[model samples]
Target: MSSRQRRNDSAPQYLDATTLTAWRNVRDAGEVVVSRISAEMENQSGLSLDWYGILLHIYEGGEDGRLPQRELERHLYLSQSGISRMVSKMQEAGLLRREPSPHDRRNVYVVLTDLGRDVFLRATPVHHAAVQRHFGSWLSDDEIASIGRGLQKVLTAEGGSEIQCGEELDRLVTFGQSVLALTSDTVAVSDAILVRDALEPLLLADAARHVTPSAVQDMRAIVARMSTLIDSPEEFFRSDWELHRLLAGYCHNELLRSMYLTLLGTLSSRLDSVVPTTNLTPYLYERLSVHARLVEAVSSGDEDQVAEAAHAHHFTMARTRLVDAPGE
Candidate 1:
């Protein structure tokens, strides 16, 4: 049987159409193309095309890797709260975050976390491969190109243009190289301050206010794990990121998420270069204690309390970092 026949062979005997000659029939036949490929992708990889589409839109839609929730709602035709809730779920999975609009506070923007971006980068290839397996293998490149051009003409009427994920990756790689070139001058403390400021007030405050009960439980579980692993700083830090990454999802602001993540990348890279693991070992208990409190504050659904706790932690951490240590 042909690939198309094999893909959807459950047709009843009365629905006996071996070939699709009409334009409407052909269009209808292609309607399930995305669903078929997405199914294949899910079977092979855990990522679903729906999730991939959201990430793709954000990656392609925004200049600074941020896209408004409103635009997503339009593109996907989701209800305001529908998009809000879906992004919240992805946020819980540590794949996305929310932030208020820089231009309009009433609007929310969706952005990918570092982990979210990484997952997207990995899943896109699996998606392309799945497409080839399910459909591309049957069509020649020329045929595919012809279909693309033909479809573009129709898409043009709707003001849609093609955006390649590969192109976006290339741009990111180039930008990353430029940033890496200046790592010598990047200051960890300064970057940390900028990130902390953005996160503690607007981004995290939003998250705390919108946090669901299940989210709070998940975060507390991560914190509980941290307490057990405090002596094991390596494992503790992993859980640390898990808790914060989960918290990032609650904000529902794309712009804030982007800004916070950018500064954090710089802060993390610089801190890794400047701080030794041995030096960090002495402070794991304090780190765990502070994080436990931070999670509880968020779980309380009190944005003010979260901000206060976060502020106190930062200052406390800074003081510890600044104090001179006697020779070990």
Candidate 2:
């Protein structure tokens, strides 16, 4: 059977509560990584991690390290359709140019443009900080070392090689479970609302009081904090909630804050494959100001101001996102 067919066939396997719960934690952790990174990338150079990955790959894999799309699909573990869409979007964005292979007309190679190279260079530091904050900050020195070995073992095992797992391996698994279990708080809603209210006024005032430049800086600081705690799932989720609540506070309309919070609460509900990978790019970063401005207006406590700011902010963010590379 084809891979897709096999996946479809496996869909109905009975999910025991333990396995289902484990799957949920895994999905939640991955979502935190994606959402936190995407938010930071959007605020930083405006590139999504997927888009950034595409550029990073092409940049590193020029003539010396050139790769075919098929190979890229394997390395990135993206489906054929996913790879195609990413390449197409990057091409349209003028970050890459595709050419038919000299040996096979049907084959194509993606090349990074000069502009794209410049973008990657400019974006690299931001990417580094984002990755460091999201994945780096959470691990202690010992956990970090263990994780490295564990990951190496996984890769080698996948390649038909075996690696010994020490006692710490079990400890890692146990620790991970404990972390996820902590986030299953029944009281999160009331807790979140309380926290949301405490911070909203200042955030709203800050957003309203600042112009675009200051607003972007303020938003980036918040996203940085949000992205830094990925190790402990409970802490990660709490930080994620705090960031959103702050946004709601900045927007200042309790109703609007609540509306956006409700939407964000669904992040952990869906399966991994259900959500499309995002293409973060520079223009997207500039557009985050919309959210900031809206929150600021909401903080001002005027319905007219809230409506006007939210409308303008959301529209601009949506419109610029339309300019994303076509296939992506």
Candidate 3:
């Protein structure tokens, strides 16, 4: 039999064993929960899961809340025109507006509005329920904490990049050459799918924001959900990537997904001067705190507070990182 057939045949035999079976059940249960929550979110809030994610980012960015399309593209791994189109659509919907960036004429800023905020405020509860119904119900405090530590260990072993564009990438490459410095444990080729899964929605939402805040938020929610997969890097990456690609495929724009994968692939392979040394346990603790805060903010309908806390939480992961490269 071929390698593919061999792997598949081996998978069932192994998966049937007790340890692997339990692990598979946990993963499958989470997936079911998410599906139920997504459906509920759609029915009650009239917002898809992806839009919820974008709203969180905007909420995090705060009042006077805005980010340049290019910046969004870089931070979120979105393409140029993709973000532009998204902005236009959202502007028409009155959820977000576009203005020329003061710092650069070539750049455009995407800003949320009162209407957008109101929608987010109302949807918070429904979304929270979905989260609880899914992952929260299955996980205890200690188990969740353990998962966080495990994920952090993986991140340390697989340090990622700042995820910039062509121009920024060139600048960093040149700087590294000049300093004779490079990050150890740079993102490797094998991790491309994970990186791609991380970037896809951020880019699409950046583009969609121009069209509709709800759509942009939906994309963001998808990004957030994808990011939560610290379960099995290899399996989760493969499973999630296929799922999103399949969903994006329905739009008849394979390029949307393909481009995201390509960008992530590049990011997975690129290196800067420093490798991540973040401890998984501490990082997870921080993330758990953030999740608790998110639960509270969503319940209270305090979008601004939620946004601020989320940004702060993501930043703390750097505390455990190795400031200098691994070998030196």
Candidate 4:
């Protein structure tokens, strides 16, 4: 090949040194700010960062300062059981209370008590101060504007919008439950099967869309990273979530993508809980192969082929988790 032809055929390098440095700086700065703020929040208010976040979300959640239990779970970086326990503890402390949904007996809502509101009001200043000290202080006004513009561009590209209400909201809640069932070990096999069945069609539809080349490349990189982490279950699980996030990004439906992002916290918590004890090597390899097929199907833009690949992927995942469960 001619030298120019060889260069044209090579993969494009998206991240130059300056871009890499900026990305690392943002990541490190975020970690530092979070650490400082968490320590201050705990020391001054006796509230862990997670507790404070839950309280804050509850306070802003709705007109009545109440959020449904499942919605609350979405806002929280906790598993279903972990959030339940946290709610119980907060209730015992007179911070919050849970009420059964008036319309649906099976549903529960979390309401911030007067005391919870007061606590949140008190903690807001401390949180702001930490952010100012560790994060805001370091950035110039121009830099802040640039960062906001950059983030807005990202959000726009990702189909970001305010969470929709009504029927879409209901569907989102159901999606969250399905995700919990798929990730949590405590869910009954019957329930898991039901969740998988419900999710399969959605995944197939998402797979049928023609995703941007950047997304395809992102999945490829995630799969490569997963291969390197096969022996490190925790890291592998983290990479697994990244892969799902990329796949979810391919959904052409804005509401579906938004809902998927909302449930990521719960998904992360559930995956974290299961990774340590589960035999993950077999599952990892299976996932890598399935994802490879999925990428190919997506690239071809064949709806039937995409659906077939998605079905096989979900079946393999369910079998890996249910049939080959830890200690079984």
Candidate 5:
């Protein structure tokens, strides 16, 4: 028999039991829970999940409550025609407006209106309850982290975001240089602080101001994991990266996501740097407290408090990092 035919003949025997079960579970869980959550959210708020998602993306887009029309379309996974129709309806309802960018007349921006904000805020609790009841509540924090980590691996293997533009890819390559030259413990604390001090608070504020209900659940899960890992500093910090990544996702800015992930990647090249000296036990406890507070701030939708907590969680600080090379 041809090799292809031979493999096909043996396919049944070669099927790993774990693989079979995992695939089925992933498929079933995603479809069933999403369907139920959609039904519940629509019933309670009269806003379909897709409608809420549009308002959500715009809400999370930035402090200005706007996103470029093309970028918004790319993120929403809708066809050009579908987005046009939805935007028209949302505009009719006073939920959104498509305004030409003053900076660039050719580009239209999707701006969330005050009515959209009210509707989104009103529907948020319903969405959260449904997500928790149907999805997040069923999983332990550790399970949630593990599942997130595994799926992220799959996403990475699959070339991650289809929407990653050339510029984003080019910048991501720069993060790789630090990977080659530095490990976790050797990363300069001052350099990490520079990135964290500036960008981290903004990301946290965005998360607090506009995170989707599903993203909130993920943040809580990571915080729960961090709470349990107060003694295990390395594990705790890895979980911290997960929480920050969740925070960054809600910002709805791909370029910003890249920048934050670069900071996180450089700091967490391995893990040990996050918890250096055993004598720093007090500092570790304090970090856990700050993380818990950050989550609370996010969950409560308190933007200022979220920014404050995130700033308080700043990593170790030292002196300025010298440039080792050009364009670094």
Candidate 6:
């Protein structure tokens, strides 16, 4: 049989009615909830959901009520042009203004105007009521918790992680150099695997030696933050990278921690180049699970378990690059 035929033959033939019904119910319910809330938001506050989200993010960002332009882009899940256009409209409406960063001239900051703040404050209650009425009221406490856990698991499986473009690009360049040295020439699957084998042990060792209860709590918080970003791939990867960086910072041995960070910086950068654009959802999910497993292992403080988890994590990553290399 052809490879495609074999793949088709291997696919499941059927789904049970219960499973189908459950899936349909969830999808339909999501549509209903969003429609109801969005309609209410527009009618009551004269604001689109997008406007509310942008204003809310800015309002909660800090006491100054400012968000970096790039940071706002991540939150809004909009392209630069899209955000710029929206911001322009809002600016004309006298809701917000863009200010150039004092420290970095290239960067622009989005500051909520007094009018924007007033709108946000006024709309908050209406938004909350709509959500509670359309969505929250339907679920009991246990059901809500169960749904949260289930969704988190799905995100973890999808490798939803975050890393800033600028930082990721720098790491990629550094990593490409490291891979060149390790392989003495072209980068290959085995070379990537070898690099992982060499570095993960050091990271696991550091964690075992220095990761504290407080650090574990912080790691969990990062993971929780990551769970929320599954729908935002760019933001997810940036956050995922932040979680690893935070773990590295927890290591008591400064030299070892720095070395591990350098190695990881390179690996992540290299991987970014090779990762396929299509069919990435599954790959991301698996990546998320690996990170979640590593966090749990670290918290357990079992050297053997940590080592095993690290091995699996690095192995899966290396394998992903090998399997998903462009044209492969």
Which ten-residue region of model 1 has the weakest summed lDDT?
A: 172-181
Off by over 4 Å in 4: 1-13, 152-328
Q: 1-328 in candidate 6: lDDT tens per residue?
A: 8654565467664556865787788799889888889888777557767777788778765449888888778766689989988877777776789999888998899898876765665455456657767887788999987876766665555663332222221222112112111212222333444564576667776776678898888878877877777666555666776787887786777777777677556544534332223334555677677778889888888888888887766542321111111122
Sliding window of 10 residues with minimal summed lDDT for model 2: 171-180
Candidate 5 global lDDT:
0.65
Highest lDDT scorer: 5
lDDT per residue as tens, model 1, 1-328: 8665565555542333554354565576577777798776666446667777888888777668789888898777668888787788778777788888889988988988875666665455456656666677788999888877767766766776553445433212111101111233233434454456546567667788789999988988998898888565545655766677788778788878766766655544432221222334446667777788888888887767887877745641221111111221
* Whole-model lDDT values for every prediction: 0.63, 0.52, 0.47, 0.62, 0.65, 0.64
How far does residue 81 in candidate 1 sit from its true spot (Å)? 4.2
lDDT per residue (tens digit) for residues 1-328 in model 4: 8654565467773455776798898789879888998887666556767777788777666559788888777655468899898888888777789898998898798998876765665455455556667777789999987987876665666665343223211111111112111243322323333454456558547745758777778778887887788677557667866776777767777776665555554445544222122223565667667777877777677888888777766641322111111122
Cα displacement (angstroms), candidate 6, residue 98, comes to 0.4
Question: Per-candidate TM vs. native?
Answer: 0.43, 0.42, 0.38, 0.42, 0.43, 0.41
lDDT, candidate 5, 1-328, per-residue tens = 8654575567355655776899899999999998999888766567777887887777665458888877667777678888988888888777788888888887788888766665665455456557768988799999987988888777766655432222211111111101111233322432553676578777777657778788777888888888788677667767877888778778766777788878777666643333133224665567778888888888888767776776666533321121111122
Tens digit per residue, CA lDDT, model 3, 22-52: 5787588758876888777767656655555
Cα RMSD to the true fold for all candidates: 20.8, 15.8, 25.9, 23.9, 20.4, 21.5
Candidate 2: count of backbone clashes, pairs at least 3 residues apart or interchain: 16
Q: Cα deviation in Å at residue 302, candidate 1?
A: 61
Q: Name the regions of candidate 6 deviating beyond 4 angstroms.
A: 1-25, 153-328
Q: Rank the candidates by lDDT, best first.
A: 5, 6, 1, 4, 2, 3
Candidate scoring better on TM-score of 5 and 6: 5
Residue 159 alpha-carbon offset, candidate 2, angstroms: 4.6
TM-score of 2: 0.42
